[model samples]
Target: MNTPPSPLEAERTDGSSVRIGALVPLTRPGWAEAGRHLLAGLELAVREVNDTGGIVGRPLELVVRDSAADPTRAAAAVDELARLGVAAVAGEYHSVVARAAAARADALGLPFLCSSAVLDALTEQPTDWVARLAPPQSRGWQLYADFLLGAGHGRIAVAADSSVYWATGTRILRDHLAPRGGTVIELDMRALTPAAVCDELVEQGATALLLLVGYPDPAVSVVKAVRRDQRLAEVLLGAPAGQPEFAEWAALLGDDGAAVPFLRYLPERLSPLGTRVEKALRERLAEAPSFVAFEGYDTIAVLADVLRSHGTDRARTAASWASVAVDGTRGQIRFSRTPGISVWQWAWPSIQVVDRDPAEPDRFRVLHAG
Candidate 1:
């Protein structure tokens, strides 16, 4: 196996382009829609950076790799990028895959700024080599729980698939809800059909059903089945993992997809910088960009700032996480050691529980914020 370049060897040669390895899930089995939006944001930021004089006058290049939602593939890509001498790595929407990439990058002494993964335990132990922009699972899910309580939803059912991400989310919801007089009932997607899910919700008398499964398959089917069921007409549908943020959800489920609340990491109002980037991203994606796209854009924005301030030394970039204060599209981006979180975290980005309006279906309504 080939080894990664050491700190001294990873330094940029004068006049050579500076490379930032981009780990994105651009292919199938991945959330390709989210990946496209993420790539669009990252590409937009890179273009803006180069147009403004690049990083220290050497053009900043994004070396893209498709993570494809596979952890092993993501880890392999990290190794390949390290051998290719990227100064730092950025972008990944899947929490499990991001954890794998972060571990590999840490082992290789490569700095990685995770764009959108929210799993609280990003690494087994804290390290300066890794940092994240998205709010962690615990914080976001607890807020979702609070939203449920505030809305008079005391009994909640989670129809979740078998995955670390979903399992962690279920645990968070359960832990957070139990003490607050809220009850969480778990419905395993593996054993229950969509109709069965509806039956369970009715039997359990669940006031709200949260989709903790993947999109377009069980999640879409569950929503459809529940919507068609007369007994479930009044039950609230929620997707705290943000599956409804993309256009594909609407295009697939139409009205059925509306009013299903999900967590999104965008401010209620965009900053001036966020406003400009949202317009550009809309032009690039040809649709309203999701919060994932904003995350992708912000990832590059922070990385560019670091590379310019600390040079292309991986060690220096890793150390500079504590000092990052770039104006991201969402908010002022900064990193610090957050309690119970293993990686350097943004502490938060603005969080909202938003859903497409049933009245319009194209516009979003902010239901709750934290």
Candidate 2:
């Protein structure tokens, strides 16, 4: 794990208040809204914790910094959070940012609970200071592939962005299907226009497309291009989990987005508790609550429980993140280290396929359960 002693300059914890640093993309170019929603979730949990008299006898505090949705920027933010003397760090919407923050948090001997970052490698290795609330990409890809094959969409076309997370997912999906003799056409999203890629897929008799882009901007852009190509109307469109994180992807695409299905964290049927959480978040935010928001809320809730059990000692608190089991917004949350995936990861997390209404993209219906 290579966790070091807490730095001398790091904020000293004397139980006056338990501060947890939050890293989100508050000012990123395309991910500003994602940052806002993720932060809302963290704040929601913080308010709940403080309202209940906090941990032990100290009130809970969140020291927030913009991760900027970039790996380098997020790494620096993790250092800043450690220097601020937070007991632990949580909240990250982008996998790239989470990747850097996780490593840096480990080096600083600070506990970090990631809210949402599905890249396979973030938790692939053992890190004493890190535990993720999201599932590994390997699991997500398997779920996605199973859904596509079961739906009779075997000839797939993949459009992958240049980002590390997107590229890694595309590679993982490709490898997963190789043993089944599945045919996949791969295209570089950064190098080609969406229309051109659609045309190539059409020519190749591709029955489906998996958009492996990091942001909604590019994913929606490709959906628009594909929709305009009237000849490819029957092509089954699919996306990684990023598509459902932001409402704009569906709202902006309208009918086009509704036709495409994407991985989403919501269960197939909302339980009574889930309905209440949805109502609370809808009242809080103008748009519908995303899984990212719920993840942020759950991450802190789990950490607060761990803090109650382990006290404010950062090392002990960090080590206790793996055993967290709390029901916040979602059902019971837990973690395990898998042989192929990262250490202390939420394994086999279920995700559903979502298709939004053309007239009301804010509202969606789950078409498939994962």
Top model number, TM-score: 1
- For model 2, the stretches where C-alpha displacement exceeds 4 angstroms are 1-15, 214-216, 269-273, 358-360
Q: After superposition, how far is residue 259 of candidate 1 from its true place, in Å?
A: 0.8
Model 2: per-residue lDDT, tens digit, 59-141?
A: 89998888777789888888887777888889888887788888888778888888888777884457777887777787777
lDDT (tens digit, per residue) of candidate 1 on 48-112: 99999788778989999999999999999999999999999999999999999999998999999
**Ten residues in sequence with the least summed lDDT for candidate 2:** 5-14
**TM per model?**
0.96, 0.90
Return the number of clashes found in candidate 1. Answer: 0
Q: Give the number of the best model, judged by lDDT.
A: 1
Model 1 TM-score on a 0 to 1 scale? 0.96
RMSD of each: 4.0, 4.9
